[model samples]
Target: MGGERVGRGRGTPLRAVAYAAGGVVLLAGCASMPDSGDLRGVESTPRQDTQVRVFAMPPSEDASSAQIVQGFLEALTSDDPDYKTARQYLTPEAAKTWRPELSTTVLSDVPDAQPDRPDQDDTGSLTYTLTGTKVATVDAQQAYAPASGAYNKLVHLTKRTKSGEWRIDEVPQGVVMGKSDFQRNYMSVDKYYFASNTPGAGEGFLPTAVADPVYVRSHVDPTTRMVRSLIGGPTNWLKPAVRSSFPPGTALREDTGALTPDDRGRLTVPLNDEAAEVGTARCEEMAAQLLLTLRTLSPAVEEAELRTGDRQLCTLSQKGADDVAGRGALHRPGYLYFVDDEHRLVRIAAGGSDSQPDPVPGALGEGEKALRSVAVARDERTAAGVSLDGGSLYVGSLAPGGALGEPVLRSRGKTEEDRLTAPSWDAQGGLWVADRDPGEPGLYLLAEGAEEPLRVRTPDLDGRVRAVRVAADGVRIALVVEKGDRRSLLVGRIDRSPADGGTDEGQAVTVVGLRSATPELEQVTAMSWAGDSRLVVVGREQGGVEQMRYVAVDGSTPDVPPPAALTGVKAVTASEDERAPLVAYSVDGIVRLPSGAQWQKVTEGTAPVYPG
Candidate 1:
């Protein structure tokens, strides 16, 4: 997070005291100067038909003592290059008081210095002057001056020369002065990539557009950039830019504890009975699962394969050893869990850190176990009696230190028709899968001892089910579909009676307006019970904005409103008790909350929630 000051800025002079006094008079009602209406002239005055008025001139008519003083101060403090011509407007003592060093300092730093040339309508020389000496005050050095009041001069300035060209000449004493106190400091660009600010998927940059007014495109990679937060927009700069800085809040750092994996190269933990048990441990578990899964599935995880893109655009191979920055009092963690042969979740792993580090951190505890257990396997034949969860194991074959394993996909069928597009399980032991073949959309239900899987056909829904879940009654099924611009939450009933063929399809209901704004919600990646009656749908919005939303099982419109003005929502899932669900966005950190809890995270990570 490095930042440099903009070279171009408006000028403010030190001797504008007389102008300040005029402003004070206007404030007190003693004098009425320009209001918004008068300021409008400032714009129009530059566009008049007459010979272009290069600079403004003082009024021709006699002005009050205050006005005269304002004219004097403005002339001396003017940024215009012809300012030296104002010498004639000052009194003898005032001319001597006009310092050259001040003028040089003010004009030297300007990006481009071209003063306005005098115009035909310029006012003539000075017509008034004032002088005073020995006035006690504070000087520019911030030190107090003695009781003696030093002599000062005020010059009445105008744009014109002689012969009605227009001008007022003569400096007056009793000058008032004002100056600005803006300063600059060092801002490192590295900070923007590592600090934690807002969570979820959002797009902003280090030094951002304003601070680093140079870059044309500033996109960051969610996998590695590790940006924590954003700050200093037009409205807010005085506040801390990222969540990790200074007086940290609980909302950001609550679940940031460390966890290590157990023996058997597995992160085993008991599943809680309550439906809404979303604890820090659960979150850590989920995060580990996703990262480990990604590591095993993607060929690019190797030290030499981590490039900017797929198929070799700009190779970003990983280099060097692995280590974790010190675990902090406030660090949010990510993990994942799976079932072992004994029907217990035995493995856990740490999710990739969201906050960028010069040298990234290593996985803690079950982190290695999760990674080592990840493997990709393929079975040649298919059968209807197969359970998708059968081959999936919670523990790895080797110890926790072993390398990751690839994913394994299992299905039951004679041919490719037996392929499953959408697969989900209900608490009632029913598994549902969907397909989008040309003949008809296929929906299959597999239960214990059912030789021929219950099959349902819905040609209307060729490729709808990215996510499927069994309803509470075990008699109903829910299918989440993604179509053109709209993604719907669809519900149907499980029918045992064979229909046109040997399959049974659930009735369909439309959940519209789910993807009203882009990016659209194209895929339903995860969905869980928000409560006994409510459901939360976590999916990818069109253009890759991850989001979480809710709907009711009673066929009512979803009440779970999207996060207010939130941008990145990577993944969403429900807790055991169906209370709040955690959402992982593209932002550097993960945010946890119920349907109503706002985004909260301490440090940043890709996946921060898991169910065990």
Candidate 2:
């Protein structure tokens, strides 16, 4: 197995992971690229959730300069529309000039309760310091990026002569808020985009939806803002990688009108004259994008229509939308493979009854050698096996009578803890695995038919990469790196650079976009890609017990809990299905779940995996 030792009943199993205090801190900045298509008839409006409340009011006027600065910081957490109350803390001119939408620095710690007095009073204008240990930031462009260290912020206030009140004159373009209040006032919403390589990708692999995290009003019409944000291009960080399908210069036809869903959950959106130029195929693509993006909103969208100045563009069905983005590509594994007590490969049909697990006709499958865990390719045409001792990785066809190839990827670790992680496969049939050799840690990638594995680099990941899972989109990676006795769950964007002279691009990852995806979880031990943007992880809090939950790449947790608890769990895995069945290797043995449906034991096993 990938761990130091396989778990046995009541034995000292492998160590677990921990998480950040409180729930995961999902910072603001979620929005989809605006672009929707023609409905056969008129495009529908969006649904507005009326229950969300407006933001809290700012400190009363005539407050002290420092108090006004403090009140402005607090108002940043409110869900007010247009941030009018937050603006009240600013001088009217500054209010007109200040752009809070520039970016939001989400502090992992609390802001200073009292601002540091100004270094020098500049006549009527005074400056105060508000700094904290920064966690992450969402910019005006809606780009989310992680930032470390203490943020040095200064809010400059001016004494207003008219009301004898002090108001902020100049401050950072973005807003700043403490983590706890951020949770209370903010919510996470996904903006839909097609994968860069999918059929809907007019160019390369494009994300159909961009999940945007924002401080949505708790009781007002969040739908309008979500749609507006969608029409806006993806946040700046993801812009280089993904493109929006919305027409050039596209915009809502109405400036002040809100888009609301009808009783049947159908939305009609009115676009300006610019969107009137798309063809039928383009219109369908756009509508599909809207269907997926709007589905995350309250009252949800079942179907939708598009309109240009009341002139019907076209309509799209839910199924059509799903098909366009290939969202229905989820397929359960044909057979669940595991290693048995005798060090042989075994399997259980995904839909079979409680029958004794069976072995196959290959070398490893027929008990040729002791194996630790297994990885099946997405095509299910081939598989990879790790040596029971964790020193080697072998690849072979999954068919009966298939001969397991020589070790395709080998490890050079001095101890069991430094062996290779469970191998993962990307969409392009590339094998990705990492060596946990603490003294010489490295990541390797092997494409089909390659003679040897090529080493890939992790720029800022200084610790041991315990686990690695590539997303179905083939652009992002979910990794667990253990460092300084702590583990973190992070998301890295893959950069495929052109190799020397015109060869395929060399695959490398940058530390810049590698954001801390699971801040709530401190020591993440095991992780698997649950969907394109979410991961089902097993982790614990610092000095706390282990727990399993589904968290987004943006540090947002699922609305519901994960499957039942399995103490002494050594490894857990799931298929690409967002709600797919989970297979775990507990101290008891190999178990599969649908929850409460008895964990049908297959055989004695340590590691298990499904096609990504």
Candidate 3:
């Protein structure tokens, strides 16, 4: 949308283009056809109807200042690499200095450009003010973050005395576009890196892959760009918790071009000299990271080979990579554990069709103490449960004849609603829970599920935490915080340190840098980590009906469709392995949603859970 124009000037009337089912059709003014021309049949090659590419039209000669601003904004949404066409609308100096890659500012809708009065001093110069409601931003590192408030910027244009052509002389640092255009031009991909400083995660133990999600151009050579981003190292937000196996300064070989998997689904990556000196073990780890990150883009990529110059550094197959780093996509929980009607922990085969429910082999399954909620360790060797009163937290072995020990942690909250929330286990065997006491609300963690509970500091928290779920990487935690009747979902980074001599000398942990993951949801009843950087949230928008959807940690909705609708969902659980079926406690009782099917009611139960 543009502001009122003073005059049409010498520019030609703007022509409208309409998108049709087959291709784009340009609507032009009436023109006379030449009857004297030779009538020859034109031959053309038929292209696939599904393949469509949209290109921005270049600026017409003698264009007005308003048309120049509009054309440049449209060009930013095109698929052109390096935005070559967009620069044509800018002055020579501005074109040379403009950096569209610096960052992308997303708006709620197309920006409104309003022209200001002509300059009294310089008649040839004019400025247009661009304003919109901000949505989010993608930084140079490609990391996405939710942004709010107003977006106001100015674009200055000048008319050339020689050609009388108008071009933008001053523009914003990065391109700005509406949310729809952003979804069409960019896509999200996760870059995998090995977890850093995780306790007991050392040599001979499988390194955990931490996901750092970023956006890349959809039509560009995305595979190559993704690889380069991975080699460039994790984003700054996640850099402290993860480490790249590639040596510093390692990059794609200068000669290498677009990357694609061969017929055998093997992708060979050529790196610079920085990676040539790595040993066989470290090289394999590097290859593993590449395979994991690429597989997210192309499931066909089954193997990856790392090369430097003419020599092969190392080659790793999908299975070999899984051996080096844990296989997140292929892992399935052993069972779908839930609280049965009798208030005992019971389970059914995770992948079995006819398996009947059976109580677990631990003391919690004996029904000695009625359970309220439960969390199983990643290894499925240990279990933690809150009592029916929700005041006591118990940890027990899942092995047969395992006895239930004294409550490892207890809450002093007086009422059930003010007691401990459901517990969550991280990959490092750490248990996380939040106390909802009105007077002394806090978040606590049990290192290795045996040490004294550590109160994790929430320096920036604004409300009482209602629930807590730690990601598998153990470096991120999600909390449902309630200030009043309204509840919001927030994800924070976990910082850990070994305590020195002090009054309470133990491992000190703090949850910092809290950011809203569901700012649109007025209330979040339940949520679960469904993937590395995705969560299945059951929440409703402001004044809307309840629904379920998958939201990324950055607060943007994923491309995947939402789960099948169900009524009165009380609790939800999903395994880090996305292939595992979704289990939830709804009005119909415990139900499971198999892939591509409707929800089917399971045995009467509540608080279903999968290994965290």
Candidate 4:
């Protein structure tokens, strides 16, 4: 994941912390701070300002059943705070029962309204089959997961006795909005959660916060809603993997109003009586969580204070939050490195610079053995690489006078991607390699000091694992898998056994819940984790050129401008900092952005990387 420090990240990632008690302040050390040089900036084309249409009155009284169906679908797309206008399309009785916040079904296109019986024009029943792909679904609990196939919905309408209006009788709760409309009406937000601080990678128990991406009402006080959702708890899938400092059943004091920050960027969350039962330390934990979650907003709240009615609790400032950020738990490598023409590992400084590529000290620099792809350990003292023939994997020390070691893991496949993929190092110092062996493809894990690699069985990943990068968390893996001609980016949870009773490498660290993080990218050639929870992807659509953009692991792509272009790129890499400029190995050479200034060439290299 080889460099020592990163420049400032893309956005100020959610470095804020959460607490349980009153502001005693936490001590979770995140990452090693790197001296950010002049941070490179991209002068992206300005975003087009567009005004969204809010909900209007319901369909007219004389509207047809199909008209009402189509109008209701369009109304769902509108940024209506309450479903009042949409309720107009529904029967008075049904309006009171329907709940649109249950789940958000995001379709690639608008819903296609079709009569169950096309021949019956006066029939009371109509179906709105979602068009394009389902893309992803955001449940009522604010959990986002990638979903495929169709979202065919049946809606029944009954004529209103008083107004003679064609009103929807029964339909599912939650809105079904088109992707375009979803983009306009909803916002992609991240609520923060604490990483499980189990000791690993010889670093002991270091804590860090992870971002859980979800969609919310963009115009609605989104910042406050994020806090509300945080108190509600993490999604079902991530609950086991993450920790929340807030006490269970903790909620905002106000049941209906949106929690807002003051002009000083201080947001105070008023909790229920449950907070009173909790201790002061726990109160600080609660405040830390609020600080981290609220800071993800556009106009971020810099500080958070907890309260019960008028009584003030602990206050968590940015400094206290930063103190416990725990980001450093996942070490960022020191420099940008890649395989040179001589098949030796070489290096250059990160960020936008025209630094000459130099051979890294050690066996990798000697190029005694031909190397295809390589990954450096977080310690910067060891490396793993795939042989030029793609038949074997090798790990050696980066220290001076070291030599390439024997094959740690080997492949028996026929294709390049199958035989061996790029080796990756996790924060735990585990070396991960994928054997594409089309005949019996599999992913294997090898921890430091372990002799044999343990086979990792992943769901639906039969022989399709194209690239593997272990995240800093050490418990998750990001794989670029190919299915037919289409490629999708997915993140899988690596659930290790309850205790360390078995072989470290062979221990059953089950890789479960393979969720798509970049379903929109038609083909993903390479990818790297940008921050604690975000990923920088290198791919193109069905016919687009290789480009790079940032995407959240929950299949949520940021609403920023188009990604920077990397012409003829075969692979890409970036500093752990989300804000750092990306480095790519185009057909020409190694390139880094704000290309607006110029994607300065570092050298001729591929597989440039930093310690994961």
Best by lDDT: 3
Q: How many residue pairs clash in each candidate at the backbone level?
A: 108, 62, 0, 42
Model 1 has an lDDT value of: 0.30
The alpha-carbon deviation from the true structure for residue 36 of candidate 3, after best TM-score superposition, in angstroms, is: 34
lDDT of candidate 3 over 17-118, digit per residue (tens): 424345532111011111122211110112212234445667777466666776777777766778887898999999999999999999887666666863
**How much RMSD separates candidate 4 from the native structure?**
13.8
Give the candidate number with the greatest TM-score.
3
Worst 10 residues of 4 by lDDT: 39-48
Least accurate 10 contiguous residues by lDDT in model 1: 208-217
Sorting all predicted structures by TM-score, with the top scorer first, yields 3, 4, 2, 1
Candidate ranking (lDDT, best to worst) = 3, 4, 2, 1
Q: State, as a TM-score between 0 and 1, how close model 4 is to the true structure.
A: 0.81
Q: Looking at candidate 2, what is the lDDT of residue 335?
A: 71
| lDDT score of residue 14 within candidate 2 | 18
